[model samples]
Target: MRFQWLLIIPFFCLLTACSSSQVHWRDISSNAVQASAAEEPLSLCRELYKDEAQIYQCEVEMSALLRARQQCEKDTDPSYCVLMAEYTWRHYKDHVLEDSPDIKQAGNYPVMCGYKENQITPCSLTK
Candidate 1:
């Protein structure tokens, strides 16, 4: 029984060691995603509209995009930031008129943390 317990302890220890690899996976994948996710929103007005009326219309839509850009900056997650920014811009262009719906200032910011030694460290995990 004593020998069996000794073996069992090492087996359990190995299990924990293997689980630590999950952390590396998370760090790499999230970082990779974050790196790949960076993209600026498509300009609401591809080129400057020469006419005053056209420029004003373009600016209105641009406001939504600007708000989306601001919201994207607040998140640490790359994919989510892209999704929210793109969604707000697309939604505003498709549904809302001018600046009716402020989709930019929505959604909660979630935090992801890592451990060192025995302490928890707060981190920006994006989305």
Candidate 2:
């Protein structure tokens, strides 16, 4: 029984390590999302469309996600950064437009970090 307790201790420690890393990654991605959502083209787009009359939302979100992904890449693995960016972007978008039923539909983005249709546009992850 005492030896079992010793084994359980390592298991708990391993769990804690995994949990901490998850939390750290989450925090990094979330922070990047929030910050990118508020800066540059996003904010500019919002200001330009205070009435929300157009579908500029897709472009805005793509820009913000790209910015967030870049920030996450700077702080962690590139592939993981992509996942984190998409996850946090979805989270942020869901909360921001919680009442808008139409916002639930996914927009046209690229399948990866790079642009697909136009180089002048923002990167998307859903080509």
Q: Write the per-residue lDDT of candidate 1 for residues 16-40, one digit (tens) a residue.
A: 9865422111222333333234453
CA shift of 22, model 2, Å: 29
lDDT of 2: 0.46
Which stretches in model 2 have alpha-carbon errors above 4 Å?
Answer: 1-55, 96-127
- Cα lDDT of candidate 1 equals 0.41
- TM-score of predicted model 2? 0.31
Q: List the residue pairs that clash in candidate 2.
A: 110-124, 110-126, 110-127
Summarize candidate 2's per-residue lDDT along 1-127 as a digit string, tens digits.
8899999999999998855412123333344455466655344444433355432553445454555565444332456546745765566556755543232333332223332223322333222
Each prediction's whole-model lDDT (CA):
0.41, 0.46
Q: Give the TM-score of candidate 1.
A: 0.32
